[model samples]
Target: MNANNIVDATTRSPARVDEVLDRFFSLSTTRAATLAPAYEALWKTLRSNTNGGKRFRPRMVMTAYEGLGGEDLAAAAHVGASFELLHTALIVHDDVIDRDFVRRGIPNVSGSYRDIAHTAGLSIPTAEHRGMSVAVIAGDLALTGAFRLMGLAETNSATRARLLNILDDAVFASAAGELIDVDFSLYSGVPSVEEIVDMERLKTAVYSFEAPLQAGAVLAGAPESVISALGKFGREIGIAYQIVDDLLGVFGDEHATGKTTIGDIREGKRTTLIAYASTRPEWSAISHLVGKSSLTPAEAQIVRTELEACGAKDFTERLAGEHADRAVAALADGNVPQRLVDELTPIVAAVLERVR
Candidate 1:
């Protein structure tokens, strides 16, 4: 299929998934009438935060389901929505950890609360505390909502248990990875490429890719071999996704991405591209570009140029292609249905080619 067709398919998948999420959000209000005011605030915050995401995780779930020959689109969509809710929980907590104030062009949960506190004439430190408190509670609410949605999804007991197991494991692993990431940022020594990849896999790959695919496969009653094959495929794609994101942090259009360019460099994130560049002998220019309090647009451009010259961008792109090839090969070798392969092949291609 062409790129446009792939976009259309992916678009359709998210719309279906969002519809399910909307249903769940509406149902969440049934108890709002009887709940305490604080509980009502928590639920509303969770729902609002969950609604603003791009639904990438949910798309992954639905794509895997369709690829595995599952015809129950509604059930798949509901499962995808559950994943989205889980992802929202992760993001809300992650933003708190990162002390980020914005996401997708709006004040993040914490930032919104901070704004309200500031409007009420609170001291700056007190406002910050109020924001963080609300964010922490909102994150917990989102996490609980994720499990509730999963339990309410239509599926067999066996499938439900399997999916839950995968989801639970991914959540735990992701939390550990996030801790490692935060610790790494605070330390001085840089880790090896293998260690960096391990961090990426644990913090990102499994939950971002493998678990979603596995959940869909379980729902579809896919064979063990097929599920395993998809797992490998998802891991590779997930890593590439992170690499692309890292690249965008330095070079992408800020308007398109809804994030400040070079924020990763400012935050001192130890990404694969950074790891690779730092190991090279001619990395002085690149090294100086990162780990700064702020970066000027001209400086960011120069850093982007240096990154390209050092072959970091090319290397990342090549790695993404390698993973995409592996994903496609797995589908072919595992005898997965052709229609699913056709749907995913272009999606993988687009992911590798994405600029923002």
Candidate 2:
């Protein structure tokens, strides 16, 4: 596909991604009859997550594949589904850890189970346990399903092996990053800007961008130069994406973003903004309120006000812009087709706008 063709395909991002997911659902539905009833419920949760979002990871895969000269649309679709499934699993697991009961304005996987328990008149403790259990199982199912989908892609064995290797490393690195995130949250001292950037690259960038891009390039038989360039693009963009996400988590309106402004503050997420603010003398005034489970809107607004007052917000924006520039530079070095580059050009801007 030429770059113009790729641009045309971008317009169908939702329909194409959903079409890929629908095929998987059809097969899963047939298999559901042979599985335990609980498994079916979990599948429903997976379906919910799959149906929402812009399917950013899958878009990355398809765009990279087509950009690299792969022509088999069906092959791309199946591969796209695999990445989507992996992302869904990650979100489910993240929700479980954050104790978030809702996503996309609906009860999340765990929240669905919690609702069921609530309907059954279970106590809060029991309901919460049921919710957590279901979310864990649901996440596991999605994670395994992702690999299975990858295996089912219509590709050569050698190609699949390479893709799997890339994916496995991404998953491992992402997990290590997650563990570090938990540790960072528990520390009394604020994490440094460098540490925060490094953590975001590992925790949010790898599987989210790097693995999918590398896998796509590998499937397309692209050269190591292209694959390496895509890796750099993914890493830079992914960290930028995460940093913008952190900004939104604290400053964005819930109605517009579908994310709670107070959640990160309540969880004490170790974002660069918080780290920068910590260096300010005002840290002593609001440090205790950051991780408080009872963090109110008033308290969250105070943090936001201070984040802006301390110049952390601008610092974060500058950092994100710097990485975005690096991402574009990486793409420029890839010998990437102009049209392909054209298709990807908007991603950096879109990510920046996420803070709104």
C-alpha lDDT of all candidate models, in order: 0.76, 0.80
lDDT tens digits, residues 289-351, model 2? 888889998998888888888898999989888988999999999877676687777777777
Q: TM-score, each model? A: 0.91, 0.91
Candidate 1 Cα deviation (angstroms), residue 135? 1.0
CA deviation > 4 Å runs, candidate 2: 1-14
165 Cα displacement, candidate 2 (Å): 1.2
Please, what are the lDDT tens digits per residue for candidate 1 over residues 189-223? Answer: 66666677778778888887888887888888889
Root-mean-square deviation of Cα positions for candidate 2 versus the true structure, in angstroms: 3.7
lDDT score, candidate 1: 0.76
Location of the lowest summed lDDT over 10 successive residues in candidate 1: 1-10
Highest lDDT: give the candidate number. Answer: 2
